[model samples]
Target chain A: MVKVHFTSHLRHVAPSDPVEAAGATVADVLTDVFARHPAVRGYVLDDQDRIRLHIAVFVDGTHVRKDILAAPVTPASEVYVLQALSGG
Target chain B: MAERLYVSTRKGLLVYARDAKTWKHHATHFLGAPVSIVLPSADNQTVFCALNLGHFGAKLHRSTDGGVTWTELEPPKYPKVETSDAAEKEKAPAVAQLWSMAWAGPDKPGALWAGTTPGLFYSKDLGATWELNEGLWNMPERARWFGGGTIDPALHAICVDPRNSNRVAVAVSCGGVTVTEDGGKTWRVAGKGLRAEFMPPDQQFDPVIQDVHMLAQSPSHPQMWWVQHHNGIFVCTDDLQSWDEITTAPISHFGFPVAVHPKDGNTAWFVPAKKDEHRYPVDGNMVVNRTRDGGKTFETLRRGLPQGQCFDLVYRHGLAVDETGDHLAMGSTTGGLWTSPNGGDDWMLLTAHLAPIYAVRFA
Candidate 1:
């Protein structure tokens, strides 16, 4: 099981509390999470299914960049979805 | 239960309730972010708030319980050009903020129209999904347009004809105005008779390049349109084919929000301020000018308003009148709220502190 947690900025869009979803990889966990709360899909990802520019996703405390959801995940992996503390 | 007012400002959203004799500040939402625009559905059960996060981009939040709680939804974003070229990003227009919003009416429940910087967007599924109206965005005149006070040219005023859902008119600051008869499919620039003093004398009346600050067409009178352009005020009496400038104001012709009487198309109210020089109230005195005979003459209403040392300004959506024109509310950039319960005859200060107000909508 993978634990998926959302940042405070996105909590209003969906439950921020970490949720458990069965998955062997980050991609599968994200698919499971998006399946449960579809409204967060657009905010976390763009129209091309790529992570939004300001959004950062990490698996087991390690940030994932290009292969957003391809990172391998163990049962104890913790996924964090956060908006980068940024300005431009 | 009294009528409620929704005020959006640079700081947040403020809600107020008014009874027979007094106004009460009720609640505040989005405590920190700049809430540039907000609209309450006719039924008052649902409200949509547009927040402009400086670096995070634009966001839209909906409140089902009269603004007590909000659910952030996917806001309108600049469309990704279908082109696979890497340069597509540089050419795409940037969406600065969701400056304005309106309901498509009960005929199409959950349908919404959003007016944003650089273009317009429409949502059929209650803001969950949005599609940019590329027809208006692709016009050749876009390259020549620019913003006045705002950072970028925007579709500030979206007047949807209640009589015909397909007929809609939008006003863009520095980009003039456009009317779409096919429900956002195709658009025609409709700035006839309006003049822009800032433009070169040769192109002042071209209609497409005029600096239109605001546009208002009362729901009761769909054919009668009023445009508060940057240079002067105009009224369209011939189905938008042409307009007549209302040059009878006692003060400057430049202003922001123009509130038309809900029932009487000939009657309207406007806030007069100095033009590009200062952008504050004319003569450093705040006053509301109302026209009852189609702008033939404007009676100045400033009974309880600040008489001297008042320089607050009103935005395009900052002055609003409820279903009954008698209940008028206006907010200022200096965080002042004023209400006229007797149809603009007399006014009273509601509050003097909040934030730089962006919009005032009475429900």
Candidate 2:
């Protein structure tokens, strides 16, 4: 069971508790989360089904920059979805 | 059932009151040229405006008892030095144009902070006196890069942590975000996730210029912040230590402003424009996008806004929300003054004639 922490703003639509998903890849975990929380899907995925430009995902403390959300995940691993920063 | 909207334009300040559902314009030549920023104090008893006075230099004006009359606040004078090289020191810091201003204490009425083109200035005696926060001006990085150049190391936005008055965050354009944890004695650059990729090839060594135009902190979560940059929109959870890109809008890269809903952390808004050379609107058509889920997605709101050939540039300091709980989004375009009451779902033309608006605030 991997633990994914949603930021405060996302907590509105996300599960009240950290979600538990059994998956070998990041994509599988997200798929499970989306199945439970449909409203969050549009927030993270664009029309092309690509990870939205504004959404950033991280495993542990490092950023995962890839098109495929199928990055490796372990039962004890942690995931985080970050809201983007902008302006000058 | 109309609303009265006050707008500052190039010609001067104008009052547009709603009558029978139509906006009527009343112009006042309170300032010469276009106004850059308008700040209404917390009590709504004072309206302070920054006006671009051409070669005469930028001036700050104040009006008490609403906008009935105005008085120009004399620019604060720093002690002059008499030396053998008087010529060099005599030259004023190239006409410091005020970019942004904020009133700090709700309990202490007169506490105010103002950010200008040259540096940051503060006042405890309302607008009667001023003192420059030299700690920000004396930044070594400012002198090495932005100094002597057109870019001012001045603060663009100063946010006093509602939870802790001493905890302050100031957005310094071209200087990144500076935070003071122990009051204003010490400050540090909090630009980790942000990059300044727009810099010249030679200056590529510098972190991408995270020219933060606006910074909004969630009242519920002080660590969470939303920053509007020339490059893109960013969100930070660790007091700006790290950031995530939450702007996936069609024109995400080229917006000048960002406004977070005062009550809802999940609800925030921004204006979008084409990137690169096509940044400004080609015609009169423009759009205001609001992100109900913290900028993960944006829906364009264009009910009453112009659609055809319109040039509407919603500047950095333009759009803002009032304490009344109604979202008041204002913009300065080649066209005139526009306001949106129901978030950004629909907008109304408040005025038809005025100079390009540089800034707008409820107070």
Candidate 3:
């Protein structure tokens, strides 16, 4: 099981604590997280089911490449989803 | 005159109400969000705001009980493009902004029309769900639409005929004007006689590529419409079939917004600014040009406006006229707001420090 966490901004949309979900890849982990907290899907992913351009998703402290939902994740890894620090 | 005014700004949505003859700030919503446009429902009971969130994407909010509270609605979304070409699939479009919206005429209280960048959307249940107007989206000429001042070409002005709800016309920034008679099922491009100086001489009058800044239709005369084009001012009397350029303004004709009188199609107002590269008020003086004889002559009104080194720029949706046509309100890119009680003859600076105003509408 991997632990998934969100930034404060995402928490405002769907309040949550760090959650543990089982997945071999980041895509599966997000799918697992979205199944439980449906409202966060639109904020994290766009209409094309890809990570939003300004949203940063990190797995086990390593920055995931854009649209790279297939990156492998360990059972004990921690994934963090945060908004990019841009815009005024 | 409208008792309430709504101003959509770069930072938030500000509401103002008239008390006895003076306007005062009433409320503010989405304090830190970029509100691109605000429109009240046909009854003026429900107000809708479109926000361009920097990170989360475009969002829509509704307030039925005035501005006290708001409920987020499902914003319109572009369908996922199905293509095998990686280049085409990677460049799939999204709703970059909600440029304009209108109530789906008087009879269809449950329906609303939304104009967004790249396409138009129709909502049947007060914005709970939206369906893209496929007819306008699939038009082959859309490939020639390019961004005017925005990253993507935007469908900014929507005019629904007051007499018939099914007949609607929408103005795209660089896609000219498209009209539909059978609701959203079918559409035709109809911007004729509009000249584009930016294009080559041979393609200057192409209807599909004319850049229309804003479009306004006289409420009493449904067939009379006014357009603030990138080149200059144009008026259409034979519905949307053709337009006639008006070049009699005393001041520079380059501007964004055009407000026509509700009761008289012959009266209209526009804020003139320097052309193309320089967008500030001409000669560092802010002025409004009013035409009462169907654009044959113009009166430069600046009695209450700044005559010194003012650099205010009114956007395409910044100037609005109330139902009575006697009251007018305009907001500027320099965070200035002004109101005129007797047309454009005189103006009063309501507030000079709000935010960069994107649109202003009376409620």
- How many clashes does each candidate structure show, in the order listed? 0, 35, 0
Cα lDDT of model 1 by residue, B219-327, tens digit: 6777888888787889887778888888898788889889998899888999989987689998789999899888888999998888878889988898988788888
Q: lDDT tens string, model 2, B1-363?
A: 224455666656665554555456644546445676677755555878777544334667788866777776754333333444545543435434677777765755787778776466777877877887777666665554352124455567888888777677788667777777765666777767775657766653343246776788877667778887767887887776787766486645667788877777766677777654566743446777777787788787788887877677777777776555454757665636677667778788776555677666654
The recovered share of true contacts, given per candidate in order, is 0.06, 0.00, 0.50
Best candidate, lDDT-wise? 3
The DockQ figures for the candidates are 0.14, 0.01, 0.69
Q: What is the docking quality class of candidate 1?
A: incorrect
* Cα lDDT, model 1, residue A40: 72
Order of quality (DockQ): 3, 1, 2
Candidate 3: CAPRI quality band:
medium
User: What is the C-alpha RMSD, rounded to one decimal, of candidate 3?
Assistant: 1.5
Q: After superposition, how far is residue B111 of candidate 1 from its true place, in Å?
A: 1.0
lDDT of 1 by residue, A27-69 (tens): 7887888898887776676544556667788988888875676
Q: What's the distance in Å from true for residue B108, model 3?
A: 0.8
Q: What is the lDDT of candidate 2?
A: 0.67
The docking category that best describes candidate 2 is: incorrect
- For model 3, what TM-score does chain A reach? 0.91
